[model samples]
Target chain A: MAIAQAPPRERARPARAPRTPYVLIAPAVIAMLAFLVYPMASVVYYSLQHYNVSKPWDNAFAGLDNFRTLLFDDPLFWQSLAFSAKWVVTEVALQLVFGLALALIVNETFIGRAVSRALVFSPWAVSGVLTTGIWVLLYNPTTGVSRYLADLGLMNYGAAPLANPDTVFWAAVLAELWRGVPFFAILLLADLQTVSRDLYEAASVDGASRLRRFLHITLPHLKDAIILSTLLRAVWEFNNVDLLYTLTGGGPAHQTTTLPLYVATTAAQSHNFGYGSALTTAAFLILTFFSIAYLRLSKFGAR
Target chain B: MMTTQTTGRTLDRPALPEPVRLPRRRHRRRSAQRVARWQIYVPLGLYLLFTLVPFYWMLVFAVRPRGSDSLLPWPITLENFDTVWNGLGFGIFFQNSLMVGVASLIATTVIALSGGYALARYNFRGRQLFMIAMLCTQFIPGAMMLIPLFEIFRTLGLVNTLWSLVIAETVFQLPLSLILISGFIRNIPMELEEAAWVDGCSRLRGFFAVVLPMLRPALVAVGSFAFIHSWNNFLFALMFVSEQEKFTVPVGLAYTLGEFSVDFGALAAGGVVAALPVVLVFAVIQRYLVQGMSAGAVKG
Candidate 1:
């Protein structure tokens, strides 16, 4: 009893060193805040006030007008925002599914798996400009693959995909998908390795069929990965300009013009600085919401 | 999906305990495997074929004669290459892209390695908040920073300079690099560094000698990523640089097409020339890129 009492007395005699992980992380924090937070704060400030590009220094405070215009008065803004919604959802969903399916097949220990993965990953190396160029060539009316198909009694009208306003959006989406799918394939393959083979073996032993096992085990296990992958890709898709710009330059009649292209056209090409900044500010908020909601949602289920 | 599964499993799995029937079951299983293999190959083969056709077309366009009307029926010639070399300033643009890509890679990699190392090794204050903030940087749309970034560069008298594009691309490169490297650093056990420290090496020396070598894979990953990001950068280059000589490949190629439309041959030639380095670099360092992307995405 005396020995135990003495041990307790010694243990309680000195307090543990205070845990301070923040001290180590200060540099990254400062770098981020300086580069990211400061810019974001400035964006908010600019959005609230009337910011003129030509007369940048002549700052005037215009409370909610910028937001009002962005929301209700601007049809292009709404159209572009709506396009982004459809754009990210359709692009990301199909890319993820196709990528996952491809990854699953390639992940198998089959002949030529390495070559297959390499071939698929080749597109990831090609620049946005090259991908767009190839697609544009394919969509050419006179001498492209589409025309060839039409000549062979396969396709109808032979109208180029990019030139058709109603179809231009899908054309842009496909171009983006060609670039985007490899991302999911690569990332999903990574997560797939982290899943232990023992789990599959055990499930199979329990007479769980592959389909049931995939749904209950693989899908559930891939939750964190799926959410993270989708979010990252969505953020990218929201900001992506090269694919859309190269494919259609916002399109036959602004059908494929995304928020980024719109902002670029407005500020740089059109020289409407104040309104452009206002529109850019709106785009930032929308993207910010996408990111924050994603983070919070993922964080909630991250156990 | 359900029918495919049912068929696959029925043709693949069987549960029985019999000695004399073993050879028959084994024979049956062998033929079933063959059938299953074909089924798997069909869809995958078609997808691969569909995906690669465009790249095939690109190659065709690149190598064919300049005046060839048929993009498909091609007598492959070096004439297109010659035209691209002579007419489009392909050599100059190629050199500029390499310079900018390498510079951004070096700058971003150095900063990320040091910063990521510091964050990983020390159990200090504000680490979580710092990481979250780093992530927050990626959250904001890249286009949002265009005007402000352009304004800053203009004020600093960096417009129309390669320095402006380099810095802008570097800024774009930094957050992702840091984030990716941080994950790799965290994988390295602290005991390794501690052992070096106990052997009389200073913290900085331990980092350089001990930690840096272990970070080779992550370095390769981040370097390749930085290279690609810089190479593909169009918006910043378009906004910042106005001089013809200062143009990077993407912006230069984009400009090949004016208001009326594109010049396909010249654009195709430029595209081919521009993509060559990318393909070469990828072929050499693809292992690292895959490793890095997978590693980065997992932690993220």
Candidate 2:
């Protein structure tokens, strides 16, 4: 094959190269199939079976019983799904607003831009557990920020935000927001940099106001980036359980339990793999539908 | 059209008066400078406080004495660090996390490099399907895969082992790393590789001699992403590894948080320890991060 296909000048190279790509991608394909795709398929399979590690005798093919229970009987399922929706919307929206602002601010030629970029974006690298740890200290009643504020007669001492049901949602939101916003800032800033300065200059020269310039040039340019980052962040915020698990423990009576957290609880604490897989399936369907809807509605990359 | 009209208007305006325009232009410039200054600094200042205060609070609690409320760690103490490091077994967790992180980094980069090269260089039969599959995997929540992954790991006898974490992290990291590396490899001209081949180098040797050297930044970006993600991963480490010694940093910190009678100082200390490596790595690679995202993500 090599000799037949080869021209005189390219005789050194072989035409037995069609299989090279498959061979190269074999490891990745195998790994993803083994770890990722296989697990997903198993989740779907187990969602239909009564698989519980604790109760071996009860294990049998459930055949949509888990889904039936999830859709009809489970109040916590609805509650968690609602909370996940609320959580994702609130976090992504706020993060986008603040992150875009921060990106715009730092994108300017400020004196301390380098240091400020590093400092402000540092929280992004911190883990969810670590973010929980830091916020736990800040929200601590006795020796935390409340005590210091109380010392200055600004607010009451022993104000336990995480413990209070009324405040826990906002408390979790604020903490997650701190770490989450930097992601938007970093991504938006990246896109912001690619916006040609000449566009802005041309707009300004045309007597366009700053807001108009942004609306016309910068915003349009960042349309696809904003869409991509928000979708990714929405999925991430919906799936993330680390901060809520540690900070509030989805507590004050499961006030903050996202669907993923609920699934984790079911699987880990109750050992109900079947129910957990059902919840997993539900969450997966919701995300897939939501993402597809979001992309379609946003008209992603249409320009 | 807009640019031409604006230039034409500017040309017409210059005919009115040069002398009158000078002071007006200077006045506009001054006010714009003033507004721009406030616009940059005020919000940035407030945001910096928001960003830095939590970190500062963590540092204060980590360093101050158990009972002190001085706000500042005037008399710095390492007692919390000492207790968490040795007593709470974070020492073992740290070592485990490092092993997992480094191992995942190596695995993700090497595999992604091969897969990315294939994607970039080949017009293979299943190329479109492969790319689409990688994209679809992004929507599969890691948390949802816990039950099945746990079952898989248990079947493989990898439960309570760090290899479970390494494998899980590598799988999750592969799609993005592969995409990013392929995007990068696509940017490098094929002529360079062809030139190397023309000099009697095999395709493999051409890649190593010509392409690999140019792929340093992409490798670093992909490698660091794998390391940071694996190091911070909690669910896999929590579910797969039950033993104390097999714990990662996140699992250790989560346990510290879960204790009924929480020790603030030790928790803060553990948080700091968990934060150190990733933050440092982030600080170094952050410049590339924006660039990498722009190149690999936005375009894709």
Candidate 3:
């Protein structure tokens, strides 16, 4: 068959190479399928069955029983869900504002700009568990910033921010913002460079103030990047459990427990696979719905 | 198109040049630009304090002699580094983390390159579906998949192995890497490859000769992301590998954070150890990050 074919046309892979794309995508698809899709399917499947590792004798198919318990009887689920919403909203909003401001500031060419950008953005590489470690050292009552503040006759002594319910939320927020803001800054600053300087020059020629030029030119141009980064960051904050797990451990009556954190504790500590899977499924649905609704409401990519 | 010049926000001065004083207009504008210098520095200085103090505190704790309460890192000692590295076994964890990070980087880059190429150049059946499915996978939480992944690893007899971390990290990192790389490949002109073919080169040869060089920034961004995420991954390493020797850096750091012996110096030392490579990698790759995002992400 090859002898009859044209030699020049058959050089690449012959006529049977039509499935090259499939072959190329095979490894990624296989890995994702084995790890991502398979586990997700199993999570749903396990959610319907009583699959606690410690209590094997009592195991049985649970159906909607776990869902029933979660919906009607589980106050922890609702509380964590509420906290998850609040956490995502607060973190996303604050990170965006501060990140945008920081990006604009650093985007302007000035003396010491390079060093400032490097210093301000350095925390991004630190790990979450390590972030918890650093913050724990700083949050310690006697040896931390509060101690120094007390020496200066500023803040009172013996104030444990992590232990107090009123202060833990802000403390965690501060630590996370230290890391999260840099992400938005990098993304937005990238987009900011692409903004045509001609627009700003034109606005200035039209006697527009700097604030007016920024409002009319910079912010509108950054819309898509803002929307996408915020959405991605929101999903990430919802799913990420490292900081909360190591920082507060969702303690002081689980005040900081997000839904994913709750699901992790349910699975890791209690070993209740059935209910944990149920909680996992619920969280997945909520994320999907929220993401779609958010994109729709924000009119992302609508121009 | 409205250009309302309100001086309210930039209210550094109350007096303005009279419209009749046309010659003073240039001077007024120059002064306005000059006076705005503090606008950038003042806030940036405050933020730099927010950013650097914690790191300084970490350094102080890591190196300061034990029981020294002074803010300065004077009379520094190597005791904490010695304790964590030799005594607490972070040395082993560091080697393990390096191995896992590099392995995951290689695996993710290779797989994502091929997959991204397919998505970039081909319009095959189910291509859109494949892309959508990959995006959807981002919503799946790593914590939620802990139980099933543990079971899978157990069946594979990979429990307490560094390969498990490598595999898990590569799997989670592939989707985003693929998306980003595909976007990058789309930006490269298709004519380059076609011209290579016209010059008697095969597709593979053309890719190696033409496409690969232009893909350097994208490769750096993707590779660095893979390494950093794999290095920083905590929950999977915490869940999948339980043996002390097999533990990665984050797991080691988590132990230092636990309710056991609270050695601040050792913990901070271990943190410094964990933060070193990624911070270096970030420093090298961050310049490409902005360029990569502008080309691949913002437009898309």
Per-residue alpha-carbon lDDT of candidate 2 for residues B185-292, written as tens digits (9 for 90 to 100) = 777778898999889998999999998998877887898899999999988899899999899999999999989889999999999899999999998988888777
Please provide, for model 3 over B1-300, each residue's C-alpha lDDT reduced to its tens digit, 9 standing for 90 to 100: 222232433345556545456644543454335325788999999999999999888999999988888899998899999999999999999999999999999999999999988777776677777877987998998899999999999999999999999999999999888887887877787878888989999888998899889888889988999999999999999999888999999999998888476888898899899988998998788888878777764556
DockQ of 2: 0.45
Q: After best superposition, candidate 3 residue B292: deviation in angstroms?
A: 1.4
In terms of lDDT, which candidate is stronger, 1 or 3? 3
* Model 2, C-alpha of B198: deviation from truth (Å): 2.9
Q: Which tens-of-lDDT digit does each residue in A48-109 have in candidate 1? A: 77777667676688888887888888899988888888888999999999889877776666
Model 1, stretches more than 4 Å misplaced?
Answer: A1-37, A54-59, A156-158, A295-303, B1-35, B67-74, B259-261, B297-300
Q: Which ten residues in a row have the lowest lDDT in candidate 2 chain B?
A: B26-35
Interface RMSD for candidates 1 onward, in order: 8.9, 6.5, 7.8
Where model 2 places Cα greater than 4 Å from the true spot, the runs are A1-14, B1-35
Over the stretch A1-303, how does candidate 3's per-residue lDDT look in tens digits?
Answer: 111112122223334567988999999999999999999999999999998999999799998999999999999999999999999999999999999999999887678987788778888888899899889889988768998899899988998999999999999999999999999998899889898866766677677777887798998899888998998999999999999999999877999999999999999999999999999999999999999898899998777
Docking class of 1: acceptable
Task: Tell me the chain A TM-score of model 3.
Answer: 0.93
Every model's TM-score = 0.87, 0.92, 0.92
TM-score of 1: 0.87
Residue B81 displacement in candidate 2 (angstroms):
1.0
